[model samples]
Target: MSTFGTLFRVTTYGESHCKSVGCIVDGVPPGMELTEADIQPQMTRRRPGQSALSTPRDEKDLVQIQSGTEYGVTLGTPIGMLVRNEDQRPKDYSEMDIYPRPSHADWTYLQKYGVKARSGGGRSSARETIGRVAAGAIAEKYLRLSHNIEIVAFVSSVGPIHLFDPEATPSSDPAFQSLLSTITREKVDSFLPVRCPDTVASGKMADLIAEYRDKKDSIGGTVTCVIRNVPAGLGEPCFDKIEAKLAHAMLSIPATKGFEVGSGFKGTEIPGSKHNDMFVPHPTKPLSLATATNYSGGIQGGITNGENIYFKVAFKSPATISIAQQTASYTGEPGTLEAKGRHDPSVVPRAIPIVEAMAALVVMDMVLQQQSREATREMLGRAARLVPELSRQEEKAAVEGVEKVLEAVEKA
Candidate 1:
């Protein structure tokens, strides 16, 4: 289905070469504040051609809110957002439309849909993610109000280069906030040919990307995302498990080659004795149960455990790099092709915000699910502080009622 989540439904539409692309967010609560400005920064981060490391295609990526609100605040209706495609260069892709780029969805889309758009890979392009990022930003705002959740993603790896310690912890940990403060689109672009985050590794990867660029080729990298302050009990169990939902949301992004949560693949190597998170109850904070180690990555039993939840998604480098390779035309004739288009040598940096956006979408969906259970005592337990003066009034009323019953028994 094009839409995601049962309550916080988001449906994205349009083609890469289409005049416009956008998303419709249904089920947004009324009175929440929203506007184009709230969603624009995310679009800017995901927009291509922002730096040398990203594709050279330039688009203003302006967002316009058409419906779902008046005067900035949500009207409790479906929220609709639009971003016009301004910097499309269809001519550069005219030839590949017939041949289909290797490792791309051109062939698969044709087989499934029977027809395909001849420009910019149409819906398959990363351009489609614009709607997702926009809609996700709204979800983020909703989450910040509902649960105080914050999501961030950064360049964790590029090619063989990674953010590693000179000893064991690395020079600086790749925390989302810390990494974002240091890197910008310009900084990333200046070193875009190689998507490395570490200066030492970036320098080496840069040389490698330039060398490959000279030879007309590309590479791949991985992005790591962290979800912080996600309230416990945000996930549903089993099939709609939080991790399952997160993977589903993330895998939909173009060129996303892999996904893993927490220790992920590494968990396989450790013995059960070493891998399990042992719960330790806090004294003063009786409500808190925490593990000294966070190998579970803040999730247990498919629900958030109020710990930092982190994951890594690997993206194959831009396939449209100017590489002369042997392939066949749509007619099955042998041919030599050199892809010509404005493209990133690597896309891991530009994809940072997209990763954060998807995580926000998932967490927000869970928060809404929790909100729907507000009446349950178990749910109420989580928000005891919200009752304010009503809690004291209830207690006083109970005491008075008890005394009246005792007086009636004595009179009898």
Candidate 2:
């Protein structure tokens, strides 16, 4: 399960206390400008100890690209990126080897593998996500430069503090609709600590995190990610639907407990007639289909409908808490044990980049798949010309289209 994606694949390796944690990204398009600079910012955003509300462990989390590049450009090979675990304190987790922290992966990993890491939960550690963030940075760069696709994610909720009213009117007000259609990553990151876009909500979320941290407890939260400018028909109709893949990518992250996309569960409350996205002509393209209402969240029938794709990821509170708890040990003996380790009070802020990264990966894979499917469809359509069309002009036009398709495939 470490490897993900059909076309553009990423396989992550290493663990929290390992010498390094990194990934090998395959299927990257060649000649993209890629350096440590492009991959570092997301790593920094996802790094621990960024603020008082996060873990106290101060890790630089610097990424080093080992291969798949030539002169700062991608070589169209498996790109290998590494970020050394520079701030691991394995001693703090020594007790976890026997006690098995409640709600953590300790006991599960041990039970599944018949052995576990002496310190953190090895592959289950959040630190492993560094590779995902790094690889997703590459996918994001490619998507942005190639397709003008923009992925933005922010802290949407912390415990009970939500950024928007779930039952409130959505995308109806012209001003509010415009704001959502044109939001940027900068605006999301503008409010720190909690990373919620609303300043008032941000302050409360930050306060909640700090309050929980002081009590040695943790809080859960949600992140909303928006992908804009993705062309229509980027997803498969059935098993590989865009929302399904996004859910798969997001839930793969540690502490993620749930997922929902556009309209989400709230849409269930509305009547089908009202919940449906009415069709409208594209603003500029007369023949193109666009939706008057985007309750579909930019996707329909498991495929992107050329609108903004928005989804929410729910992250459980960091499992490694400092609170003393009574839980059963491996030998089935009940005992009180206190867990020790630098952990986030809430996972939302750091999860922002993780969400964006996973989204980017999903889109990149889907885009490649769409391209492949298009190529095949074009060739098949070209073959269909063998059947009688009854018109010289139509046959001539089909011939020209087939030639053009062949030329493009050769170039690829």
Candidate 1 clash figure, as a count: 2
Tens digits of lDDT, candidate 2, 23-125 = 9999999988999999999999999988998888888999999999999999999999998888878998878756988888888888788989987778998
Task: Look at candidate 2 and tell me the lDDT of residue 389.
Answer: 60
The C-alpha TM-scores of every prediction are 0.84, 0.91
| Candidate whose TM-score is highest | 2
**lDDT values for all models:** 0.78, 0.88
Query: What would the C-alpha RMSD of candidate 2 be, to one decimal place?
Result: 8.0
Ten residues in sequence with the least summed lDDT for candidate 2: 168-177
